[model samples]
Target chain A: MDNIVTHAPDFFSNSQAEATKAIARSLWNRVLTSVCVALSLLTLVPLVSIIYLVLKNGLPLLSWSVFTQLPPAAGMVGGGFGNAVIGTIVMVGIGLLMSGPLGILSAIYINEYAPASRLAQAVRIVAKLLTGIPSIICGVFAFAIVVSTTGRFSAFAGGVALAVLMLPTILLTSEQALMGVQSAFREASYGLGATKFQTIVRIVLPDALPAIMTGIMLAVARAAGETAPLIFTALFSQFWAKSLSEPTASLSVLIYNFSTVPFPHQIQMAWTASLVLVAFVTLANITAQLVFSKKH
Target chain B: MTEDAARSSATQTPGRPDFLTVRNFDFFYGKKQALFDINMDIPEKRVTAFIGPSGCGKSTLLRNFNRMNELIEGVHYSGDIKLLGQSIYNKEVEVIALRRSIGMVFQKSNPFPKSIYENIVYGLRISGEKKKSVLDEAVERSLRGAALWDEVKDRLHESALGLSGGQMQRLCIARAIANRPKVLLMDEPCSALDPIATVKVEELIHELKQEFTIVIVTHNMQQATRCSDKTAFFYLGKLIEYAETQKIFSNPGQKQTEDYITGRFG
Candidate 1:
């Protein structure tokens, strides 16, 4: 007891020093937190500025004619990119039609049927590598396969390019979505005497449908904004495409073609076209988020 | 009832025939043996409970009855599991047909993310039953059999996920019996339920044995004694004891069985 009484003042003195250390530690914590907040806000600056600039420059020229009339010739005014909008939609639709089933089926095969096989592993690695390939290379590959064979730069060829680009995204996301379904669901279906195919189609596929739709929407958004592939394959027609075999005026190609011209009217149209493209992509992404959120 | 009368009642009848017979069963998962040479006879229309510690091959044996473990990669078993004297592993016996006649309920309640009506009819639907009247009748009968009809009868079209945990488990039980399989395999079906839900499921099990042979794998000793007619105690992937549930709980033949039941050690 006498020894403890003697050490009491020393313990109080040590605690005072420890309190100072704690204050320093808390000060460091607050500083680090502020730094993280500032860095995250900095990361958002480009996205915000891009939207702001597009709205500032494009909203003035945005009118009903933008979706109703064709684009004017260089140095001319009074027309809009109505054909380009349709072409974009048609080509993206074609891309989705080609990629959607193929991607989803392959994903199902990989995840549900042959998950541990060497072939599945190889396919997975190939899909991952495909995602990293430049979008321009996909354009070149499509040009070789479809453009050379068809002997023309056509909407079909552009669709082929976008399909190649969208395939990896759709495939990987669909696989992830299928994987997200609990194994318990499959076990229950199997336990109830459902065959492999029945279990997948009836139970697993239904559960994964929302996520697969989300992936498709995201792929659609990406395919819409892609400029390089459309440039090489579609090759920018001024008039509306007569058929899928003919060259088409997509929104991305129109913006690229018009932005380089010295004409002020076409430049303003480019800004408006940029706004339309941004809006389309944003709508697609928002729809994807909504679909995914609703599922959870 | 007195202990003697209860024991006599729980004991198998003299002429009762075996529904499932396991002969020299050995199981492996990628070079690691999960079960050694095992032998057992499960009688028809009786509830047999498999009690064991974790990883003691109780669940594995339960799953093998329906070939559920075959879904996993690198699982193989040597041993003839005979269902009514027909080898389940025979080349002529289709696994799908085998599974259809052997229904299983899992430890967790896994109701399909669908309507209660659809969930009960899933098995029949996959088997190509399309008549609406027949499906509706099956839904009612199975639900009543599982003791869930009164609670969910009015909301047959509602999603099964909206039900409480106990209700969902009963719904699963309802779903399992919808096919009217010869044998029902339960892998800790009541482990996820509360005390009230456990009692309800236990009572349901007692009622179900009148029509189906039930093989339940459980960790709870009291549940084994309360619900099962015959009990098989397992330890370290071996069958330590097999006898009437009353005899096993009251006077175990093996020290290991007594140790496990009395909570001395797993």
Candidate 2:
């Protein structure tokens, strides 16, 4: 075999430009990470501080009698939060009854089947704007519509008001979740000879169910915590609730009402009610996360 | 039986074209045509392979057999596609049954995020099979048919997501055949598998053709050579050459096929 030699450049040789660029990239990453850390800490510190203060002021008044007995009258020493806590639950549950199914169906219609029709686009725009409408405005809307129609403040009216605020939150979250499902999964189901409705019912919905449930849970939490909506719909009633047509109180509204009073005993009851509300909402949020986390 | 001479002699004695007949079929998606006027006779109980470059209408032609093109937003077709000697495009032809009889596997493996057993039984359940024993037997038979029985036999009750990529592909094959479709369409069945997994899938396809007519789309020429009886060569939506697999590979009569086989152009 004959051999020949030729001059060739060394392609593997290092360059100063590459090294300088690598150092600059490292410095840039450090700056970005520090900024993110600072921003997150800024958010986290206030949340932790609020929770601490709420617990410090409220835990001492959180007693068994507070949950088991009715609210005390003026000049009374002993009191409980039974009516307020039960009313809060009833209002939130009724609100979910109306809002959850309606919001989920609307989300499905928008994300799954609705082509870019004029009606669908208009509804979507309305939902987006509804996000900006204050809880107070929703309260007034429900007050005028549901409360006046019934001729009195009631738990059902509170539910209608809270659900109005909750609907946009649920619809938006569910649409985002449903849209997150891969198109490949949709095509695969369709390719398997499934009809459009069959694909939606059996395939698309199941895959998106976890995310949709998370959204509903967030809405549930929001509805549970709302006071302004409940205030206009459900006026404070120190006595027990008997009917949807009668006035009632929620934990948030009771907290607001009792905290404003000059009596020290009522103030303690308000703090206890606030603590209970936060704890209940926090527990509900945790349960939703556990239930909806996709194992795969 | 290797059965080579018997099949060749049977072809010589053929008196009628098989059930599925494509006569000068032209197909388009929107303004762009994806299949030219193609003439092909797909015999029952035989494996046909469609081989071509990317975007050559192999899968497009396969989907047209069952009018699945109707599922797409805008697709237009000309000429005829006959199933069992009746024009499939005829207004009265039931698309659901047509699709039920013709199963399709995609280029990528997709199994429902369900138990391995449930994945196979999904179609049967949809059609209202309630007897546990019948469904159990079907699950076993289908997994065995796809050659996935041994690897997943111990974990039949486990979630499908626990399976490896190759097993998932086989599970999809099992799912497709569980309904006892008369024809199976595979669009690049092994394009995503490793060489060993590819061999296993190719072998499974060979076994599958004993029970169903298989039309496979593959960019791999060697796969067509090994598994197919008839080979159809496509180029940019046109059917250039379709013949016995040996002739198509060893001695294609078309110049374009020659250029393609010789690697002059893709």
Candidate 3:
């Protein structure tokens, strides 16, 4: 009773009442933060495991020759990913070329110029719907329109399919980036006697640059690893690419083809190719983050 | 100056036959009325400030000067706003061209993420100035007019985003004046700034009125007192008081105006 009385008197003390409340509030916040932190970290374990395994499988087959050689054969010894690397680069570049400007212009219209008109609303709805369309569905649509029309698989058709797949994401992200810019900036430009187009071109675009770049990079990475669209477009090429207008090979398709083959060498090559594609994607992600964030 | 050009501001002002006149103005954002039955005159080559509490239509009135409110979705208005005697809202008028003749500055210092020189010349280039020497001269003149020349002349090529908050505000002012617009509108141009920066901006405002008809919307009563030649106090989209600066400060005619100035209520 004596101990309780001493402690109880302090608890009831006027000077400490506010302090007790503050400490309890902080404790509640800390507990809530810990639960959220733990839940997110737990979800990341499997992702880390997959990357680690891919890296482990890839390290042995990767070499200067792996970069330079063609696929060895069904049962043969040595082949490299040079052709696949070039094909991926060219295809992605072409896809970006086709989609980037349209996406940016469309985003500008939606975010800046649109006045809630029926046409504007319809365009937005269509873009939203397009974003949800499956990559396989895009592939099938391209195969029907392109493969049957051209009567052959070609990199041009693959590029077109990839462009279609990439456009919606680019449009959505670009719109978000444009919208993310504070209206104050636009108003500031207008205040400075700039035309609306000038304000968008000069002030708004530059401010939203880092975010827009991030979106473009996301599109690029997604395009780089896409296989379904490529299968309908890019055929199995063992030889070097003569032109982008014709047939070619890519990492995703090569990996898919080799991974299903009966030979150990081809299987190893598939792992190597997958590793390379994963690395390219990782490098793109890291580059975007590092260049944008000054914290690190 | 020609004798004809040296006559009344009405005859002399480029493109403006007289003052800024808002006649029978009504504003709607689709169906909701934001401004109604507004009538006022902003004199040429003078400073007129719009003062009101939040949501009292101060900023909306400022934007009406340049038709910026048109950028918003569902905003509709019926008014005749004549800038220098030119009917600004005429269907035949090009909004982009009209905006070029009237400059604007915001509460937040919004410098482009570009070089100081580029920020200044953005408007000129947009209006189609391609000569390098001319652009350079205009950049210097604008910076000088904005009271920023001495500070930025050595670093015109440097990114404007690197400047201090006050410097960025001045850079925006420089950009606005580079095109030599006949009128300038400021929307609480220094609310985000420190006291020192606010004073600098106020001084700039005083200097700017000599060449441009300046209209500002300010939350700070002191800013209106220090820099304005004429004060227009707005309440619920109505012009409650419009008079000489000194008179409005010393003897306001309305109870609401007095309360706002004295901080009795926002």
Best by lDDT: 1
Write model 3 residue lDDT over B74-105, tens digit each, in one string: 89888788976779988877777777778888
What is the C-alpha lDDT profile of model 1 across B1-266, one tens digit per residue?
97446435645554155779998999999899999888999988899999988999999999999899999899999988999899989988888888888999989999999899999999999999999999999999999999999999999999899999999999999999999888899999999999999999999999998778899999888899899999999888788889999999999999999998999987
TM-score per candidate: 0.93, 0.90, 0.85
RMSD of 1: 4.8
Off by over 4 Å in 2: A1-32, B1-17
Q: What is the lDDT of residue A23 in candidate 3?
A: 76
In the order shown, the chain A TM-scores of the predictions are 0.93, 0.88, 0.87
Q: Which model scores highest in DockQ?
A: 1
For candidate 1, write residues A1-296 as lDDT tens digits. Answer: 65564466543534666557667888999999999999999999999999999999899899999898988987788899999999999999999999999999999999999999998999899999999999999899999999998899999999999999999999999999999999999999998888889999998888998889888888898899898998889888888789999989999999989999999989998999999999998887787677566332
Q: Which ten residues in a row have the lowest lDDT in candidate 1 chain A?
A: A5-14
lDDT per residue (tens digit) for residues A1-296 in model 3: 55564456444545566558767888999999999999999999999988888888887899989878787778988878788888888888888998999898888888888637676688788989998888877777877888889888878878888899989889889989998988877776665556768788887787777788788899999999999889888776998889876778899999999999999888888888988998998898899878874220
Better of 2 and 3 by TM-score: 2
TM-score of 1: 0.93
> Candidate 1 or 2, higher TM-score?
1
Ranking by DockQ: 1, 3, 2
lDDT of 2 by residue, A7-116 (tens): 22223225555556667888999999999999999999989987987899889888888888888897687778798889988988888888888888888888887746
